[model samples]
Target: MSPVLRAPLGRVMRWHRPLMLMVASMLLLVVVSVAGLAFDDRVLLGAPVWLKPFKFAVSMAVYGTTLAWMLSLPHRGRRWTSGLATVFAVAGFVDTAIVAIQAARGTFSHFNKSTASAERVMQVIFGNGVLCIMLANLALAIILAVQRVHADRAMSRAIHTGLGLAVLGMALGFLIPAQGTAQTALTTGGERVLLSSGHSVGVPDGGPGLPLTQWSTTGGDLRIPHFVGLHGLQFMLIAALLLAALAARHPLLRDDRLRARLIGVAATSYTGLIALLIWQALRAQPLIRPDALTLAAAALLAALTTLAAVAVLKAGRVSDGNPPAAQQANLDGGRVG
Candidate 1:
C-alpha cells in the first residue's frame, strides 16, 4: 500500500495499539452472540439470554480500545501504565469468559449461587476480580485527568472527560452489588443466591422489553445509564477524531480552542443524558414508557445541548498561526496528514 493511502486507514486502527487478544476475543464474542441468538434455548431477563455475555464482550472491546488509544497517544507513561492495561484486558477476558461459560452451562453468572456451591464460589471470585478491574479503570482515569496531553488540546479534553465519565459508569456497577436480586426471591430451589443482582428493580426479571436491548419495558433498569455512561470515552474520542479528520480536509476545525470547547460541550451534554437515564430509571420508569415529566426533561436537555454547541461553533475562528501551535494542531492544519 502506498504511504498516501495507508495513513488515513492505518492510523485509525494501528494508533495506540490496542490489545490484540481482546480485539480477537471481541470478534469471537460478536459471532457467538449472533449464533446464540439462533441456537441457544436459554432465556434470562426476558432477552435472548446470550445477550448478557454479548453485551459484556462488546463493552470490553470499547473499554480496551479506548484506554489503549488514550495511553498510546502519549509518547511515554509511568511504568505501571502497561501493567494496568494488562489488568484491564485480563479482567475483561475473564468477565466475558465467565459469562459465556455460564451461559453455555445453562446458568446465571452474576447472581447464581442457587446452582452449586462451586458455582457460587466461582461467581464470588469473579465478582471480586471485576471490582479490581474497576479500580484499575479509576486509577487510569485519575492519571488521564492529571496528565496534560500538550500535543492536542481537543483530544486532551476528550480523553480527560471521557475517562472521567467512564469511571462514573464503571462505578455504577456498585449498585448491582449493593442490591440483591429481585428475581432470586421466587426460586425456592437449592441454596438461593443471597448476594445476586439482576436488571429489574420494581418488577421481577424476564418481562416484555425493548427489541435488542431488553431494557425492561416494565420497570427500573439501572443498566441503561450504566451502559450509556460506560461508552462516554468512545463517544467523545470519536467526536474529537472526527473533528480532526474533517479539519484536515477543511482546516476550519484546526481552531484548537474551538475544538476543545466543542468536545467539552459534548462531554457536558453526554453527562446530562446519562443523568436523565439514571433519574428515569430510579423513578422506576421504563425507557419506552416515559411520562410527561420525562418528555419535558428530555426536550429541555436537547434544547440546551444544541444551544451550547451552536455557541461554541460561533466562537470558532480559523488559526492564522499567530502563536506557534502544537504539533497536533499543525497536523490538523495540514502539515502532517
Candidate 2:
C-alpha cells in the first residue's frame, strides 16, 4: 500500500480527506478568473485591472487545497467535519466573489471606507466574508488540536506543530489591517505618487522589488513574514513527511521519534525566523538590504535550521523505530506570490 496508508489512523482510523468539493470549486474560480486579464479596464491600485480577481482566485485555490490536506490528517468520516469542510468551501467562493466584484467595479477591496451606500454595502460584504473565512480557519485549528488522529507519532507531532504555526501566521496577519490607513507615497521623475497598502515604514511602497512578490528591495514590508508564517504549517509538515518517507530507504531516519524531535526544533526555529522578519520590517529595513544586523539575524536562523538537520541525523541514535507524527507538502501544489 502507499507509505502513508501503511501508518493508518490509529484510534481515529475511519477518517478520510474530503477535498473534492473545495478543490473543484477553486479550480473553477481559477479558470474563470483568467478571462479578466484580457479586459482593458480600471486599475484599482498600481496593479493590473484583473489583479484582484486573479490574486483572490489563486488565494482561494491555495487555501482550499492546503486546508483540505491539513484537515485530512485528523478525523474524516464525521458528519460535522464534512459539513464544516463544505461551509469553508462556500466561504472560499464568497471570498473570491467579493474581490472579483469589487475589481469589476473599479474600486479598492480594502481600507476604502467609501461613504456611498452601495460602496459601503459592498465593503461590508467583503469585510464580513473575510471574517467568516478567518473564523473558519480558527475553528479548524481548534478541532485538530482537541481531537487526535492516529498516525506515526513523529508525523503526528509535526502536523500539530505546523498547523499551530500556520494559525499563528494567520493571527499575525491582523497587524496589517490594524495599522493606520495612510497611503504610501513613491517618488518618480521628481514627482511624488501614492501606492497601495503594502505598508512601508522606512521607504516607499513602490520600490525595486523582486518581480511578482513585490516585497520591497528598498523598504520594509511586513507582508514578507506574514506570507512566510502563513505557510509555516505546510512547510514544516512537508519536511516531516519527507523525512518519514526517507526513513524507509535510509537508516539514518529510522527512529520516527528523532524525526519528530527534529521537526519540533525546526518549528521553534521557524517561528523565531518569522518573528525576526516581522521585526526587520518594523525597523523599516529593506528586504534586500545587506545591513549587518539583518545579515546577522538571517545567518543565525540559517544556522539553527542547519543544526536541526544535524540533530535529525543524530536523533536516530535512540532507534526505537517509532515516536510522534507532522504537515506541509507544497500543500496540494499551492503557490504563493
Candidate 3:
C-alpha cells in the first residue's frame, strides 16, 4: 500500500484491541462458514445451513470494526468507553459463536425450541448474548453523543448520527420475535411448551426468499430494516469520508459547515428510508414488492432530501475563493439595506 494509505491504516490498527480481535475472529469464521457452504450441502430453512453463520459472522465483524474505530476516536471517558467496548466485543463473539455452533450441529440457532434441550439452551445463550451487546452498544452510543470525538464537524456528526441509527436498528430486532405467531408443541419429555416465533411475517419461515439474505420474497421480513439500520453507522461514516475526499476538487465542499449540512441531509434521508422499510414490513409487504403507497412515500422522501441538500448548498458560504461581486455585496448589505 502507498505511504499515504498505510499511515491511516496503521492508526486504524491501533483501535481497541478486544474489538479488533473480535473482528479478526469473525473474519476467520466468515472464511470457515464459506467453506462449509461449499462442502456441506446441508440445508436449513430452505437455505444453506452455513449461510446463517456466514451472515452473522459478517455482521458481527462489521459491528466490531465500527465500534473499534469509534472507541479509537479522541473523546472523554476513555475508561468507560474501553470497558463497554470490551463487553460488546465479548457479547458479539458469543452471539456469533452460538450461531456457528448450532449450524455445525445441524440445528436451528435462533428461536430454536426443538425437542433437544441443547438447542433450547443455545437459543437462550444467543438471546442473552444479543441483549448484552445491545445494552453495551447503547451505552457506547451515549458516550459518543455526549463527548467531542472529532474536530471536523462533518465527521463528528456522522459518527453520532450513525451510532444513534445503529442503536435503533438493533432495537428493531426485538420486533421480529414479538410479531410472529406463537404455538404450542410437545417437548421430548412429553411436556408442552410454546415455541417463540419466526422471522417471516404473514407467512411461514423458510419460504421463498431472496438468494443470500433469505428475506422472504412472498411476505414481510423485518430483517430488511433491521439490517439497514444496523449498518447506518458504516454508511454515514462512508458518506462523510467521501464528502471529505470530494472537498479536494469541489470548492463548495471545502466549507466544513456545508459538508456537515450535507451529512445531516443524508442522515435524515437514510432514517426516512429505514422508517419506510419498517412500515412496509409491518404491513406484511415484501421489500421487493412495495405497493403504490410505499413508492409514493419513497418518492416524497427523495424529493424532500434533494430540496434540503440544494437549500444547504445555496445557503453555504464559499470558503475556498472569492465570491462574485453581486453576491459579495448582497452578503455585505444583507439586512442593512
Candidate 4:
C-alpha cells in the first residue's frame, strides 16, 4: 500500500497488543482444529467433535479483534477501561480453552453435566469464565456509550450501537441454558442422572439441524438469537464502512450527519431483528420454518425500517441548510464542529 493509504489504515487498525495476541492464539487453535477435523472421525452432539472448538476459536478471534480496535478508538478513559479489556481477554481465552479441552475429550462443552466431579468442576470454571467475559463486555459497552470515542459522526454511532447490541446478544446466551427442555437419563450403574438443559426447545439437542451451522431445523434453537445478537456489532460496523465507501460516488452521502442518520436507521432495524429472532426462538419455531405470525412480525419490521430509511434520506434532501448555533452545539454532546 502507498504511504497515504497505509497511514489512514494504521489509524483505523490501532490494536491493543494483549488482545491481538489472544486473537493470534485463537488463529493457531483454528489451524489445529482443522487438522483434528481431517483426522478425527469422532462425532458428538450430532457433529464432529472438533467442530465446536473450531467454531469457538474463530468466534473468539473475531470478537477479540473487534474489541481491541474499539478500545483503541477512545482517546480518553484508557486508564480505567484497560483493566476491563484485560479481564475480557483472560476470560475469553479461558472459555475457549475449556471448549477445546472438552472437544478433545469427545464430550459436550456446553450444557454438559455428566454427574462426575471432574465434569462438574470444569463446567463451573467454564461458566464463570463466560460470565466474566459477559460482564467485562458490558462494562466496555457502558463506557463506550458515555464516551465520545470517535470523531466521525457515522462511525461513532456505529461503534457505540454495535457494542450495545453485541452486549445484548451475549446476554441472550443465558436464555439458551435457562429455557432449554429438561430430560432425565439412567446411568449404567442404575444411578438417576439429570443432564443440563439442552439448546433446542421442543426437541432434543442432537436432532435434525442445519448443515455447518447446526442450528435446529425441526424446532426452536435459542442459539439463533444469541449468535445473531453477538455479531450485530460487526454487522453494523461493516454497514457504516460500506456507507462511507459510497461517499465517493454519491455526493449526498458525503455529509456526515446524513450518514449518521442512516446509521440510526440501521441500528433500529438491527435491534428489531434481534427481537424478532428471540420471539421466534421462544415460540419454539425453527428459524427457517417461521410460522405466519413470525413472518408477519418480520415483514412489519422490514417495512418499518425501509420507511425510516426513506424518511431519513428524504429529510436530508429537503434540509440542506446548516443548523443554528445552538443545534450545532447540541450535536454529539456539543462536541460537533
Candidate 5:
C-alpha cells in the first residue's frame, strides 16, 4: 500500500484536529465580520466577487468540520448526533450553493433593482432554508439534552437550565413593549386604538408601519436581539463542546472536567452575548461596529480566553499523568477477569 494510504486514519479522525479547524473557522468569521465593518464598500463589490465566494467557502468548511466532529463522538446518543449532523451538513451545503448562485446572478448586488416577483421568490426560498437550519439546530439541542440527562444527571441539569433561561428571556422580550407606539391596532366605531406595541408581538415600533419591523417580517432585516436570543442554544452547545475537548486531554476525571468546562463556557458566553445584544436592541444601536475600542476588546478577550483554556487543560493533563496503585490494581484485575 502507498505510505499515504497506510497512514493512521484514526489519528486523522481525532477530535483535536476538528476542534482546531472549528477555532480557525470562527477566527475567519471574526475576520470577515471585521473586514465587512471596516471596508464595507470595497469588500462587498458586485457579481463574481472574490470575497463573497471565499467567505461562503469558509463557512461551509466550518459547518462540515463541526458536523463531522460531533457525529464521531462515542456516545449513547449517536443516533441523534448522526441525524442532526446530516441535517446541518445538508443545510450548510444548500446555503453555500444558494449564495453562490445569487452571487453569480448579481442578485445580492442588484437586489433593489430586481423585479418584485423575482425578489419575492428568492426571499421565500432563502427564508425557508434558514428556517430549516434553525429547526434542525434546535432539535439537535433537545436531543442532546435528553441524552445528557440519562447519561450524566448534573450535565443534564446545566443544559436544561441554560435552555430554560434562553426560553424565558425570549418570552420576556415578547412581553416588553417597543419604544414608540402600539404594535397592533383595532378599528371600532370609526376609531382606531393600538393593540400591541412590544417586542413580544414582533412589532417594536408600537405600530405595524415601522420599516424595521416590516422589513424583518419579510425576512429583509434581522432583529439582532431576537436572533441572538433564539440561537442561545447553539452558542451554549458550542461552548460546552469546546470545554469538553479541552478536558479530554486529561486522564483522571477527564470526562467530568470537559463537561464542567463546556457548561461553564456555554453559560457565561451565552449570558454575556445575550445581555449585550439586548442592550443594543433597547438603545437602537448596532451590536457590531467598526469602533477601534470594540475591536481591540474583542481581540483581547479572545486571546485571554484561549490562553486560559489551554493552561487549564495542560495542568489537568499533568495532574493526571500517573494513576494511583489502587486504580492500576483494579485495571489489572479487570483485564485478567
Candidate 6:
C-alpha cells in the first residue's frame, strides 16, 4: 500500500481496533450516549430518553471485558480469575438484556411514567445493575494491582491509586438519587400533573441521579456522571501503557526502537484521549449550556494531538544505549580483564 493510504488505514484501524477491546467498547458506549442525547425525545423507554439505559448496558459490557482481561494476566490463579471473569460477564449480559427489553417496550422513559410500585422496582433494579458493574471493575483493578506489587511495584501502585479513586467516584454516584422535582410533584397530587401514577411514577426528588456527585445537576440527566465514571477506563489503560513504556526503558527492551515506538504511540494517544475526556467533563457545566462542552472537546483534541507528537519523538531515541543481550553476556562471562 502507498504510505498515504497506509497512514489513513492505520488510523481507522486504531480507532476501531480491539487492541484493547474494553477501551473500544467504551468508545462505542460514548457514541451511543451522544446519540441518546441527540434523540432524547424519541422515547426508547417510558423514561424521557433511550440512551441512558443503553449507556449503562454498554458500560457493563466494557467493564466486563476489562475484568476478564485483568484476570487473565499472568500470576493470577486460574480458578479465581475465571470465576471473577464469569461474574462480570454474567452481570454485563444481564444488564444488557434488561436495557434491551426496556428499550423494546418503549419503557426507557418508564422511570418518568412509572407508578409507585413500578418506579420502586425500576430504581432497585437499576441501582443493583450499576453496583454490579462498578464492583466488578474494581475487583479486576485490585487483582491487577496486587499481582503487579511484587513484579512491577511502581506500576502496581499507580494503577491501584487510580482504580481506588475510580471506585470511590462510582460509589459516590450511587448515593445520589435519580429523582426530579417534576417527577415528585407529579407523584404527590400537584398541578404539574405531567403523568398520573397509573401512567408514570416519575423520579422522586433526591432519588438516584448520576453516579458522580460533582456531575449532578438540578434538572439535568446523569450523562456527566456516567461520562466521568467510564473515563476511569482511560486512566487505567494509560497507566498500563505507561508501565509498558517504563518496562521498555529496562535493558531488556530499550534497544528495540520499534517496541519503544509502539509503546510511545500507545501511551501518547491514550494520554491525549484522557485530556480530551477531562476537557469534556469540565465543559459539561451543569450551570451552563452544552455548546461549551462541544467547543472544549474540539480544542482539547487539537492540543492533545500536538503534544502526543512531541512525546512520541522523544520516546524513539532510546536506541542510543547499551543492549540487554550484550550486557547480560558480559556479566555471565566475567572477563574483567
- lDDT string for model 1 (64-150, tens) is 766766666663465567677777778778778888887776567776646677787778778877887888888877766777764
- Candidate 2 lDDT tens digits, 1-337: 6768667433223332344555666677666666766654444335554665676677666766766665555475456666666666776677677777666666556655545687678667766776666666666666666655547766677667767777677677667665424573322122233323445667544456666566777777877777788788778768888888889998767766677778888888888888898888888787777579888988988897888778667556644444333223353345442
Question: What lDDT does candidate 3 reach at residue 197?
Answer: 87
Candidates in order have lDDT scores of 0.76, 0.66, 0.87, 0.84, 0.48, 0.48
Model 1, C-alpha of 114: deviation from truth (Å): 2.3
TM of each candidate vs. truth? 0.83, 0.77, 0.89, 0.89, 0.46, 0.49
* Residues 1-337, model 6: lDDT tens digits: 9998999656544431232344445556556656765675543212334455556656555555444444444556555545555555555555555665455444432334454576457656765766775786577566665655323443344445555555655664543332223333332222232322211112233333344232334334333443555556556556555545765565533333433344444444544554443433333333233466556765766676567655554554443444478886887788764
lDDT of 5 by residue, 1-337 (tens): 7777657555445644433454455456546544543554332211123344455556456545544544454456666656665665565455555555554443341122234576567656654665565566666556655555424432454555455444534443333433423433222122233332333222242222232222123111134455456545455556555544655674434556545654654465555555554544454433433245445655655665566656656666765765678998999999999
List runs of model 6 lying over 4 Å from the truth.
1-41, 44-48, 108-113, 116-119, 149-162, 178-226, 242-337
Higher-lDDT candidate among 2 and 4? 4
The ten-residue window of minimal lDDT in model 3 covers 185-194
Compute the lDDT of residue 314 as modeled in candidate 2.
59
Native-vs-model 1 lDDT? Answer: 0.76
Per-prediction backbone clash count: 0, 17, 0, 0, 9, 22
TM-score, candidate number 5? 0.46
Clash pairs for candidate 1: none
On lDDT, the stronger of 3 and 5 is 3
Model 4 TM-score, 2 decimals: 0.89
The sequence of per-residue lDDT tens digits that candidate 3 reaches over residues 85-203 is 99999989888998888777666677767767777677878899889988988998898887668988899999999999999899999999998765553422344545678787898
Candidate RMSDs in Å, in order, are 6.3, 11.0, 4.5, 5.6, 12.2, 10.5
Best by lDDT: 3
